[model samples]
Target chain A: MTEGFDRIVAAVAGMEEAARSFSDECRIVFLRNITIEGIDTLLTRNLYAERIRPIVQFGGYGTMVQDVLAADGAAGSDADLIVLALSVDELDASYGSPGWTSHAASAQLEGLFELLASRTRATIAVHSFIGPLWSEQGLIVAAEDRDLTSQTAALNRLVVEAVRRHSPRFVLMDWERYLRRLGAESALDPRGHYLWRAPFKRAFLEVWAQQLARVVCALRGRAKKVLVLDCDNTLWGGVIGEDGLDGIQLDRHQYPGRAFFDFQTTIRQLAARGVLIALCSKNNEAEALDVIDHHPACQLRRADLAAWRINWNDKASNLSALAAELNLGLDSFVFVDDSALECELIRQLLPQVTVMQVPRKLHELPPLLLRDGLFDTLSVTGEDSRRTRLYQDQRQREQLRSAVHSIEDYLRSLETVARIHRADNGEVPRIAQLTQKTNQFNLTTRRYSEQDIRAFIADEDVEVFSLTARDRFDSLGLVGVLVVFIEGTEARVDSFLLSCRALGRRLELAMIARCLAKLREQRGIEISRAEYLPTARNAQVADFWPSVGFSVTGTADGGTRYMRLIDGHAGGTPTFVTIEDD
Target chain B: MTTPAIEGRFFRILSSLLQVPLEQLGHDTSRKSCQAWDSLKHMHLVLALEEEFGIEFDDAEIADLNSAAALLDAVSRKVSA
Candidate 1:
């Protein structure tokens, strides 16, 4: 989203006051073996636009490895991320000249990776070496293994292999792929290199900053999660009401029909990886459902969507209803429609939702959606693959609730069980994700990354627990996370949040009681402290701590603090819910 | 004097990139006159000028293209050549 070098510079210059408005701050350290003075300005400008305050530190030129080694005892130890940007020429010199054999160069690179792994605790991102555009070996460079090009390939392989060993913490930027995409001639300016010791062109830096900004956004859990689609010409060639199931042009054999088929296939794939799909169509409900149910060429079915609003109502109201039914914030939704009027209406009514205007030509739709990077994610978990099924099960439970007369009988007959366990390494990503995404029921909304969660688990005084709920319908996966900091005879709850799907069942009370019982058994804690910080969406939990027998201690900075004695108050677990500990 | 068309568009880009008032930039405007025109911004100005005029500058030309007058002269020469 960064425009150009000059625009980015102007944005960075005005960021001193703009940065104070952001809630999250990320510390990034840059270590390059070349002159990289321009990168900081570019990165800062883009990051500030995303509500991320970047505290950047640049090491001296040509001292990447040395600075990483010195970071163990220096101020860089506190950095959340460390980026190593090394040019291929500098790497060759560091590995004892380009004349060294491929095997020897690979061995030296492996040692450097090992040193870097042992020396730094922050997440590491290293740039893969870009091969020189002009190889003196000419056509021989394509034939049997040459020196410079082959050495670059070997080094890139070593970098990728190193990342595999230290997965989820070490990542390679793949500058070789970036260079190929940008064309090597435009990416590297020989004149800039010789004049100012800057190896990359200014234009290349503009794109580089944009790519890194996406990575940073994904790491911070700001990726969009829901895709709200329109039905008429947006999904198929014609309106479902006019073109019936058999008349719509969605087949794979035609011109525009094939494009619609491919777009539907793309949307189906995104659903498979936990992106919630919803439909908002201004048409007869029976007609739309018939097309989705009976169309042979349709890749998406009614079951694929978590919810839908198929009526003659305006799209803005339908979208609002869909967000409420799914228990997701509007900010997490991306709306795609082929109608310019509809897109403009939603943009004005709900400014938080990301609106993507589909191009008039059907063939241009898929590429435009794919290139936006709206649904980018760094990693996927098993829970993501089972999201649609969980929502379907939730609908079944709602039906069962209406049939029963009493609330207690409905809960007891469903046979709900709460499984509580200490969060381990495998569950760190989900825990961090819940902390970032859960807004309605979150107390003291503090977002953490997987790296931050790992640090908490490694500490001696902190305790992290994850909760899972299952009933007659299906397993809800890890839906709750609670973090506590213990000191001698007292403990403070750092964060407590539950997924919206897991709420309204008294699961919060059960989870907290289990945590208290464990703390009393392990640390003999007497009291617990909790706080409720209200946000625009988290007003639902403003009085949650008080409802659980925690008395108000004080109020500060628009947040209420509460404390409760835990000497004999550990048995607050509700009777209808069964507890299973792992 | 240069053509009003060329000067009008050139000052618009300068004002937007530098985040300064249009009245503040003139032919004599240089790094010393504009608070935003530091060495880093100077490089960005060169890139913007190259993109606006569709001309590539050599290292010597880029290094010398500091003031508003120098940029206009170089771009005019490249446009008329």
Candidate 2:
């Protein structure tokens, strides 16, 4: 079954199961001023299937503001997420009236958002107001005098402003855009709404639930990070081996070539957003490299890819090798191939990796890639935008390493500098992303959300440190994170993770030593406690703590615990590396 | 009366939507006979039937379509028309 179909079935089954039982995974409270009963089953079911147990608590009808106020005052609110499902009509009481203006509506929305921001620490998702299609004012509504369309557009803009004002905590679910995509008539059943007070049709609810599930997954740090592409007809119109470099259809001017150009452009955009792109093509290595390097129409270059497997081998084995080279799991990869047989082979061999078959028609390929929303994320962090450059820098560093005689000499020659600082507001997202994506070099494979990282920063007992590395090549932005929970004269490390791209340069050791030196300056830190949590992908860092002079304390919960004395451990920053504290 | 070919295809669609065996669903079978024929499933049945037969039902026809016989009759009239 297709992933979408499987999710739908799981959602349907989850809805049926949720009606009979409660979810333990997530507690989501829905505060809406409209009838949104139709969405409960669909949302709960999809989230449940994703292992996010959803327990929905609905506010009384048309009492969203009042319900939020109550939730704010209530002690120990257990909700992890609060969904504000607001409608345009609810925002503007004069919605259908002839005297409608967006002035009051905008003010009211801003006030509501302000109240929501102040009252709740839970992740808030506010649904953007979608205006009704059939207006009583009719075609005259388009006129400036009776302009409901312009007024509604202004209200939507106000919602975006509010989201910006309360960012990382508040997210806007663009229901207006969603309705436009699904078509208003199909999304809303007026008869059903009037008969049973159902605001959305069942079909609309199903799709909305799926979209919401993706958003939730993104929030929970479970988004796929890699896109493994096949290069034959997948990237271009014809095979590079059969069709000469000039004959390949990848130009922006021609018919099929334009389609391929558009596809490559989309792939580049995804790469810019930190989706690691790798090539698994069955072609002559030199020929493929020549096409990528010299092609005028090629948007993706060798620098854009983290790894490539261009050889006459099975794609499944190539994908495994790519995963190993990149130090990422098979689960984090999405395989896109034009051949159905190749797609099937990888799907069977590497069941964990998501496999997508390229469309038969060249024109359909771009839309097919964009439609699934597989790489949907809540917010784009600095790390995301800088990922392509970082990978390119790593490739350059690899080349530098190959030419040097010894590892120590190469490290010294690079003049690598480590800048260690207490993670500030701007660095929280990158820190959270590192905790989520950095599996190989992570001491403890504990995935944390941006919200969780923010909480850690706010807590007086917790200290979160982020380390950024700069060699002769490039500045590796926020490559390592160390979160410690401080107590009286003793600190326990909650998380210690470094990005794999910055591994093997002794940066992990530098990070630890600098963190320890800084802790020693505090005068009260006598000992540092750390743990090594073994996950399927984090085996590389199992002996990391012991290597760094942390004595083995004990074993518990499928992990080994360690403690190191901080007061007497005399360690200056490594002779080769320089540390800048901020 | 519907032809045997149309009836057979109609039964198959109904069976798929209702999740019931074709042998169990007859012309006389109604919402009362099938436990899964709740309001939600009923709406889904209407949508599925409309798409399967390439016909649209009015609000009145939809409300009255509570049984297999009624659905078949409504579909037959719409298809014939």
Candidate 3:
């Protein structure tokens, strides 16, 4: 069994490389197949029962489709998702028939889909194999005797194409291809099968596990709302610390340092694409700020960042203080450190933080951070390009952060600008990413992917909108998202969340104001209703409903529901903010 | 494509799977003295040898597979058959 599995492991390693390449274009997680046929069939059965059963215990698998030889339904309740590894004898007779597509087929597939979908807790069996990734869209796949790789890719394309066509909420891995890619060595592997379910590489598995964590995050609206970056050695090389001004490399150049500089440029551009970039570096503040201020090839400066945190302090404390000052979650932040020891220290102290180790080899930094879709983006919005500059503009909002120490006075000052736009097909992807990530100020705090967002929008009662805020210092890139369900004057707030960066500025009030305005203008209502459910993070918003003039209502399911009637509507930003109409 | 090379490869696979002493696995040595040469080993050796040689073995040949010479004769007949 060990030697067999060794072969299986080697084969899986080779296929794992292919899996990476295909998943880049399409989402084919893995392909695994094993046949246990030998003279000692009874012995093989015992091995399957004792050894294999436990391995697939948490995996999603279907029952052998006796005649069709396909894995068709959930193997059992614990088996959330799966495709069966069936032999020719398992193939069912009605497979190519018409009656099978009737109500029976409906009930059959539905039961299977439900078996796995309910395990959305685990939701497995996203794919199967016959020839390859796409031999026939209808069935899992027909196992081809040869040309395994080509067949696997084809099946993968089929699954993706099917997903695109039906728009069903499915995330699947391809096993046949995954196995062949794993090869004969892995095929014969006897590590028990549990290891096969893991990614090709153990190091890569950490990233995959992180992705699962992200899925949980987006599910809970706990996505990092902003990324606070540092200038000098952090963003570019040479620093102003010792490199003095011009010595710093900012653009593409010679080996080593040039790559670090290029990565910094990529970071600046990523910020523009709507990753809230804030400069948080410890320096003379002025001397260090000068490199950004006076560099000839500098792609970013005070004008490009949403905010700047330049002061002398231990970076771990600085990052923690940065989170508190911004009112963002510690879990939602990714801190990059050029110093290995610093990164390690931060990793030890603040494990939740995604501390990216700036490779000692400078050039490798950019590609390392960018690949595997670290900042997996499904869509980029029109509001993104203006992000860096908006942060610079937002400085005006922050100086105001102190100008009116009182929250109300802060709201009253600096004429506020907020532009609310209904998200359409073009904006769905970003909207979904936001809905998946935004918490804190979030009302209902429901997370959705681009695909899920589109499906949710199909319901008539739900209305979704994104908020773009610009204050004296910055035009915070689409910092707020609002999801509301309505029945006449009673508007149930399904999900309302704002980027924490936009918190000290009272953008939540702006989002609510917009909601009220939409109710009156779009829905033709003079009255509006809302709710506030207490969450661990959004306790600040526990009183948000009452503060917004919402009347106390009864609590059910241990959740406080609020109601309010706006006689006349004014959905707009505060005095300090000026909404940029998209 | 040549028959001789294929048959040689067949004998080589049989020798390994059956654990028959290579020197004694000649054309006439029956399955009598080979300690590993049992009915079950016979089938396993046949399956693996068939895979390596690309020839099918019948029940008679499978039964008659006592010595290397007998195995060769049975395999050649199947190859021709």
Candidate 4:
């Protein structure tokens, strides 16, 4: 084996003991037509970074349908995720024949997905079939007759459409991408395929397992949310202070400057996709700002950044300050810098952040940045694309804050309006995103998936309420979510959270009052109980329940439970804010 | 490569793939002696050895590779030739 593959195998071999020590387990079951041995170790190595241990099992081979059907019974129902590692060659031998049809195969696959969706709560990731390595009818005949190549393409399209029916829970694992990355000729192991049922070589299996682990990590809300960048030599070609604005190389047509320009363009695209970009540079603030604003080749302007620190302060402290300003944990950050010293300092001091040192070869910068799957997400919501705008709007609110005299004056002048309504099908994705990403102002700190929220919306004993806040400045779309479970006139708040952007507006109190009123009027819930489960990052909300007029009923190790009796006038909406039903 | 170097590389790859200690995997280690060396693990060992030594073993030769000594001899012969 090559040295790289040898190192990977060595690393995976050492993960067997480490994988067993994780407290939380992500169980996965693979149902395939081929043998895939030693995959569990590879998956464990990939997921070890997230502190989630994976327990992998193989359902019987060539029994993909039967395995899923049996999972609804008591045997395989405990799986947290299911992977369908199937190939078209094993499924249909007559695929490229004269009159071969896809009707029966498509119907069977559809039925299998339906059974999985209805009977199981596990997340399903099915591999898309990579087309055959060679056409059976040769090049010209295959192209003319629309043989295996075209037929497989059509079947893949069908799989994509089918998976879209149950998105965010059922995802398509694009095996074709892996095949392209590793050429098709070397990816297939003919000896292994003939000796055993396994079709892929060891090298292909290693990378494929890592890709699958990336999808699993993204689904579990472990994807990084922020990208912190360095300015000197990282964003542009030279130091802004020494080289000056006109002297620095940042052109679109030149050699070294062109590479930096392309890198900045990629960073801009990342910002547009909802990654909050921040600049941490040791240069003078005025010089860097002038260069960013006036340079013709600067693709990332000052407005593109959500936050920046262009001072001489140490970057570890600056990153902490940025986290405080953005109201995020240090774990959600991916910091990139060109200086080896700065990257190493951040790696040692702020070990929570993923740090990347810019490669010495300038041309390799952009592609290397995109491959790590650090920012992978299953579905990007509208709120994500509008994230930079939301931060900018927060800055506007802060400006308004400084102009006003008192807190009450600021609230009254802003004229904040909060709309509380029962969540519908369209709001499921945003609600799930909030539960996964919000940490600072969350009362219970319970994370949920879109599938879990949908289940709650359909249950008669549970209610999911979403809050959207708007004022004179801008609209924060779907900023809050409250989920309550009711049992015999007693309502239990399962989750109560507001996005960090909506925290200082006294909207949480408004949401609680409206929730109590609605539960009393619609669901006949008389007494409401809520809990404050303190996490490392959510200590700011320790007294949130009492602040919202819920008296403490019980207390455990650092966790407080509060209960409130529903009267008509208790904890009314704040005087400055208006509450309405949407 | 010399005979000692080839043997060292073979044992290292074998020990890693089988999850056994290098000292524990000597000439006596075989499919029957080690419980982890099942049919599935045997296939993994063959694949790893083939890729490491840049050699291919036919079906009959793979079946004869039952012990560490036999596997090292096969790799040494192939690597020297």
Candidate 5:
């Protein structure tokens, strides 16, 4: 009877299960990268529209690209596929004829680089991995090979290129991978309804939904809201105030103490990965700071933490303070503490916070840390990289404060030479990232992918102004993106986002003023409209238009949209950006 | 003397990631590993092998590792059972 049940399970498990078994059997299957012939189906209206339906329906896909024919026949330009699994309501908001739209979920400026990469010469490959199709009644999954050698690759690339180039938002979930995954899952479940798949032999729909989730991740970027770190037992063995600096155990000698030193180093590495590390200690701050500095075994420095409310403050409060200083929600942070008391406290106070309890032992730290790292991996985008050096530049700029009298004089003193260029294929990724992350100065706050930004430029009516400002504070790097959408010679400043690292220097005002004038002259537009989409983080720009000499149109729905007509060059603010290198 | 099949077990494990399964795994397969053996997979390979043999390799060893044969030879030293 058991053998019969096993046979029945295998039979009913369907192709999805078969696929999993295939993976387990070959269990050794390698990722086969086959290039493509060309991207044609992506540009095909039927399939492009078809794939978008499920994403708009099931995934929280607010924006998507439809059909696009590449202006340039470029090679080596790849596609980042997205699978959209949306609810039924969100579907119609996208999948509309022509332009695309979606509700603002996730951080606006978060996936800018991915957006930009998906646009321009890049392809915004969209696939319907989940949700019910327009006429069909099941999940939709589309993803495939995108290299030039294989048919699947060619098909996906073509769609990706089209999606990347044509629309501001796109879903990228190829069907091929979904089917394989579905097959695998089904083979394992034998019941097809579970994660593996069932009811259908092939179970392509499940693949579609799962693939859409993957694509959404690529688009939204991982929300790395917090960096949880262990104290006392983890950072330095024994309590800080209790054990004292010399007394505390770290990496080097007895027990697994050295691993703590390595553990700190790993935390520092996470910081580089853009995870904001925080301290949850049952120790004194001054003493811990001393340990961070004086301890030869210490891997993380005091400056590495964005915020630490070290004291007898319950770890919940410490985690809260860290969240506030980092300007992130408590729900966004992952809290790691060795003490069960602290972890439990944070768990109670900020239930949303990801609190990890370290084992009483030290050797278990690395594996636990590594697994957590996977959970919070923020599929790094181009703009993500700007944080470490950008913050470093900001800190260095802050040091030169007393040296300058007024902010304007400071701007002038920095010998700030900004190179403003039209958004090309190469610069779109950086521009998209800026558009996603720069909230304090972002005007419209319309988050875009590299693919969307590329398409934005290809529209003669749309102008994207990419600015790279290097002041005497430091080369803030390619720090700003200004997008202007024009309609019948009337232009609307769609988005103006600048890095927070470059804030407080009046660069946003100066750059926007300059770009608007430039776009006005180049496009010969009469009026340029800009809006202040009030986000919790973007209040700084709430009065930006009024401050910069643009008339506010009206305040409606709690957002202020404004416009101005510039017949001549919008004057450049002779700003000083002092370069302070690390 | 060990069974040649031991090496086959190593290659078959690699085949899941390397794409070149048991049939193609030769001793001279060399460090040019396989087309599928990209950097990301190299990381996963290290992780899987660690789980398989309950051993850990530093980043230094990761950089040193390349071919299936080289990995197996290294694993042979680390594994007891």
Candidate 6:
């Protein structure tokens, strides 16, 4: 559905008055060739509700090259994001010309990227140009390879290539896809281009701004991690309890049944990309498990889910229980159901969880689930695809916990091995992901991007270490990251975090003690310093540094500063765990 | 739609976009009288009107229809036609 422009303007007007009170600011610079005025208002309207203020600045008209290449001018050096929006008609000299070619256009884009890759630390978003609505060559242009459409296609290929070449820094905005969705006729306004060179219609601009806001949310690591679903009509066409398993409508080959089949398939694919699948249904536990494990048309199995609650309990309670079982915050959940009452109750009780009610039309189910991109993450790593298995492995560990008598005996029987090593360039994304997503066990709570992690890996004075652990049951992929900055004889722990899957194994102590030992032996670091910056979710780590034999030096504003003399301290890895380092 | 209905919708959009009160907008109101109706706001106002009414105005009409009376006259003509 399209948003009213007046509503956006009114919302932005209200946000501008209270902008200073927002806790976080996402500074975005739009380096565009055309007039892009109202998008900032739309972006503010999108991000303000989440307590993030977006400060949208602009480069001068047709000054993209000058802005990108500037060393200290009004480019994006201090900005969190830089968006390159191009108007091919204005920037290209060969547009609609007889001797038109994509050479100059591609070269210009490459030049901008080269400058941006070296000069700017902000995340770059480049727009993909679309074909014009009306071609100069008329109907003959439809079949010709030398037409403007073809040339623009060639240039888009170059854009894709450039994004690939400078990945994790540059992202494609996919304007051409949005154009195709809106259709060229409704997307562009020729009169506006003629009047002020603002090419896109207001509707198209709103959609484009929404897309960009989605990218901003993903980059800020605000993507939902869990998808909790109701079972009755949400996953199948009928209730599994009332209607027999044979009576329920879920067939991959039929009409209405195919829709639910496709919806399950989409949820499974989301699970493959690190979103934990969970069930919060009021059904007979045995029946639901039977449907999941034995139903021929079901795309998901019982093993795909990380946790579930198939009881008669209220949905709000079930959702909270699922979050606790998974050791995730309620804010990381996205709940979906076919019952309006259930959805409304969860929305009222757990406002942090995003709730989606199924649309009335059955065929619209899959698109509605994916319409807003609630589960979109910036990049998928190897740890992401194996996340569901990691949770299932946690279930096994819980079973093992109950089997053993003493805590030390339990940890020793598991035969845990932790490999703490200096991180290579390939582990930058996973390390950054841990820094962003790990909350309860994180010290200092400093979030970094892949670019920042890459820089730390390459810096001579900084050491970035990754920790991967394996027990008798399964291997937990890169589950911890420790960033240490060395200055003279002092080593400061800039960031230390462990994933929830790697928690409760006494591995954090092993990780830190091993790294501190290496820092003293190889890097000649005598005094080690770390801080416990308290956050809303990280109270569990308040006394962690003290437990590791670091004495408190000062306390201010509820934050504790810690320092330790590494030479005299007897910090050792836990006897139950073995640690290997590079 | 009746003229009063169109007038009511038009004034609501105009007041919201220009940040002007509905009571102050009248037939005699023009760009010279409204301090908030600058060139950029004028273009936005036109675009919003076109989108809301599901009609397009001529380029010359966009420039000439600066007064409330003239805008009403042109919109009425388009809607009725």
Q: What is the DockQ of each candidate?
A: 0.23, 0.06, 0.03, 0.18, 0.02, 0.34
lDDT tens digits by residue: candidate 4, A1-582? 354344456886577687678766788888887888767667777888678888788877678777767636322777888888876767776666675656566776787788888878888887778776776666566544367667777778888987788887788878888889888776777778888777887667877788778787886777888899998888998987788777788887897998898899888878877889988999766567766766778889867888888788999999999898888899999999998999999999999999999899988887656777788777778899988877877766775754544456546655689999999999999999999999999988888999999999999999999999897557988999999999899999999999998988899889999989989988788899989999989999998888778899898767888998998865757898999885
Tell me what TM-score chain B of candidate 3 gets against the true chain B: 0.71
Candidate 1 local Cα displacement, residue A273, angstroms: 2.8
Rank the candidate models, highest lDDT first: 6, 4, 1, 2, 3, 5
Counting only residues 3 or more apart in sequence or on different chains, how many pairs clash (N, Cα, C under 3 Å) in candidate 1?
0
**Predicted model with the maximum DockQ:** 6
- Which 10 successive residues of model 4 chain A have the least lDDT summed? A1-10
Model 1 CA deviation exceeding 4 Å by range: A1-4, A35-37, A71-75, A94-112, A134-136, A141-144, A399-582, B1-42, B60-76
Better of 3 and 4 by TM-score: 4
lDDT of 2 by residue, A15-78 (tens): 6655545333666778776666646666766666666766677886667668777745221266
Best-to-worst order by DockQ is: 6, 1, 4, 2, 3, 5
- Of 2 and 5, which scores higher on DockQ? 2
TM-score of chain B of each: 0.88, 0.91, 0.71, 0.91, 0.75, 0.93
In terms of lDDT, the poorest run of 10 residues in model 1 chain A is A92-101
lDDT of 6 by residue, A298-408 (tens): 888977999888889998999999899999999989999999999899999999999999889888997766778788776778998888998988877775754544466
Quote the positional error of residue A312 for candidate 3 in Å: 1.6
Error of 3 at A540 (Å): 45
Expressed as tens digits, the lDDT of each residue in B1-81 for candidate 6 is 348999998888888888888998888889999888887788888887777787789987788888888887887788888
On lDDT, the stronger of 4 and 5 is: 4
Fraction of true inter-chain Cα contacts (below 8 Å) kept per model? 0.40, 0.00, 0.00, 0.20, 0.00, 0.35
Q: Kindly give the number of clashing pairs for every candidate.
A: 0, 1, 84, 2, 97, 0
- Tens-digit lDDT string for candidate 3 (A414-493): 33577777766677877777777766777777778888767657767778777876653356677777777777766777
Fraction of true A-B contacts recovered by candidate 2: 0.00
Candidate 3 runs further than 4 Å off: A1-154, A163-168, A172-226, A265-275, A286-304, A344-352, A370-395, A400-582, B1-81
Q: What DockQ would you assign to candidate 1? A: 0.23
By TM-score, is 3 or 6 better? 6
